[model samples]
Target: MAATRLWIAAAHDPAHRNGGWAFVRAGAGGETLGRAGGDRRTTRARMALAGLLAALEDLPPGEALAVVAPRPDALVLHTLLKPPAEPPAADADLRAALAKALGATTPATRTWTLAVGDPAGPTPAAFAAAWADLASDKAKAGGAFVHSIPRPNLAKVQGL
Candidate 1:
């Protein structure tokens, strides 16, 4: 069975403490899908876990997967790689959900890497981070409907 590679990331806006989470999944054949969401007021750790949970929820039954994330999100990696003896006091629900997901998943690899290599060009992590940032902004805006206005360049854009 081919293994799917997943990259999960979270972004937090310190100004309002709003946060978002995103996951990018790439199949063996290189097809990719991404999903992102936000919480009005939350910690980065919570958002990271949420992203992992979201990704796991979307996993196909019995499919093998390998997870990758930045080192800064060690809490998330630790939770998945080596769970604590007891349930965490904070974000217990998310932790429990993650545990459940891990229990059911068939992880292809347990190796953890810190870096995402190049930051110059857009990588999966970068894309996930951008999605997370956008989601955070949307949450700060009270989940209002958003419409896009395209422009040929910086100026001459239509709609406000």
Candidate 2:
């Protein structure tokens, strides 16, 4: 069975509401999905609350809630490698690079820049570590958010 976890992956810009809350059913072996994008008229609170419910509905039959989207306790990972450059010459190459360096399909933080990328250059080690760290943080945020509110309340809570 996959180890479930959750997290809210936000962009560096506060104005951009393109971020989403991630939910991993089980470590590297499980599925990774999330509720992304928000409209100006809708507050993140509502999106999150609704997203939580939507995500829950996908849980496998007879499965117990093992993790929430907003929580204090979560896994922690260090930067291990730099992410592949943006607009990689070839998509296959990018996948191969990430697979070789991080050994994971998806990164906790989407995109190379957010996960691990610098104009100067990001090492493979740094990228890998950053992704690992984000994985734990995202799961905790989702877990904690759910813990505080069993159901979607449309109540905006900080740090989620």
Model 1 clash pairs are none
Model 2 Cα RMSD, 1 decimal = 17.0
Global lDDT of each model?
0.65, 0.31
Instruction: For residues 25-80, write the lDDT of model 1, one tens digit per residue.
Output: 76777656667788877888888888877877866555666666766565555755
Candidate 2 residue lDDT tens string, 103-144: 245443222111212212233222222332343344434422
What would you estimate as the lDDT of candidate 1? 0.65
RMSD of 1: 7.1
User: Residue 64 of candidate 1: its Cα lDDT?
Assistant: 69
After aligning candidate 2 to the native by TM-score, how far in Å is the CA of 54 from where it should be? 2.6
In model 2, state the lDDT of residue 5. Answer: 44
TM-score for all models, in order of appearance: 0.73, 0.30
Off by over 4 Å in 1: 85-87, 104-120, 143-160
